[model samples]
Target: MKKQFAIIGMGRFGSSICRELFHMGHEVIAIDTDEKKLSLARSFTTETFVGNGTDESFLEKIGIRNFDHVIVAIGDDIQASILTTLHVKDQNVPNVWVKAQNDYHHKVLDKIGADRIFHPEKEMGSRIAAYLTSDTVLDYIDLSADYSIIEMLATKKVAGKTLIELDPRKRYGCTVIAVKQKHQVDVTPDPAEPIKEGDILILIGDKRDLRRFREGELS
Candidate 1:
């Protein structure tokens, strides 16, 4: 299904999102106060508007409330981002996703009812740190404060076991959702499929359990 997304601000973060969403077949409206930025976004977005996103009248005129999702990606100007987010919320947009400049900015957005808060730089840094720190962990995605999904290289001990034999959910509190081999991926991997040394297991569970699993308890 296609979704209508309004991206406020045309800086790197916002522009990247706009282009990706456009490519993914979503209807994107890119708005920016800078003429140059708006011009750059015009080719990638379904619609491009040059205006101050913090202006309530301008936002209303552009029908921001109609969008399925609204993203406030203003950079540097935390004030503008907050005001714009507040205005968008007042208009009763279904989902509001905001980018925070820092912890303080995030707190304010949280208070104002932002449906989702994103700290892209901090998140990217964490991802890079995870990759650098562990050879076994291929990737990490936070599902919630208590839960996470991780991709890990299968160790020698786990190589020949089936899902039923390993009993990940009962033993480690994690479920093996899929397996990624060199050239193929098996979604919802079968219980009878034997794990291989080079295969990557996609597992989902509580963060603490994932940490324990990474420590070779399941080896």
Candidate 2:
């Protein structure tokens, strides 16, 4: 399903998101005070606006309230970012996601009713570090401080073995939630199913237990 998004900045991070979302077939409106910065997004969509996103009237004029989700990707200016997010929420947009500049900025966004907050740089750094350290890990996500989910390429070590035989839950203290073989994904795979040599296993567990699984099973 397609979604309507109002992106309030056109700097590197914001433009990147606009391009990805456009390619993903979402209706995106890009806004920035700088025409040059905003122009970077025009190739993606014609719904580019030149205005102060912090101004409630400007946001109202753009029909921001009607969008399914609004992203306040403002750069550097913490005050401007906070005010823009607050105004977007005030307009009653159902999902308001913001890029947090720092801890302080994140706290303010949290207090102001921003539905979701993220640190892109910090997240990307952790993901890259995981890839660098592991040869089999294809992706990683931190669900919380103690829990994580990871995707690992299935290797010969586990080939032809059934889930019950491998007994990940009992042995590794992790769960095999899904397996991706090429384009097809098997969610909650049957325990009797045999593991293939090149499938991808998606597992979830406590972070320390996941690490133990990596060292004990996926080594």
TM-score list, all predictions? 0.61, 0.61
Q: Candidate 1's C-alpha lDDT? A: 0.82
Q: Flag regions of model 2 displaced more than 4 Å.
A: 124-219
| Candidate 1 lDDT over residue span 94-146, tens digit each | 88988899999999999999997888786542343344335688888977767
Error of 1 at 59 (Å): 0.5
C-alpha root-mean-square deviation, each candidate? 12.4, 11.9
Please give, for residues 39-156, the per-residue lDDT of candidate 2 as tens digits.
Answer: 7678886499999988999889988899877778888999999999888888998888888999999999999999878687865434533543456889899888678899998888
Per-candidate clashes, comma-separated: 0, 0
Q: Give the TM-score of candidate 1.
A: 0.61
lDDT value, residue 215 of candidate 2: 67
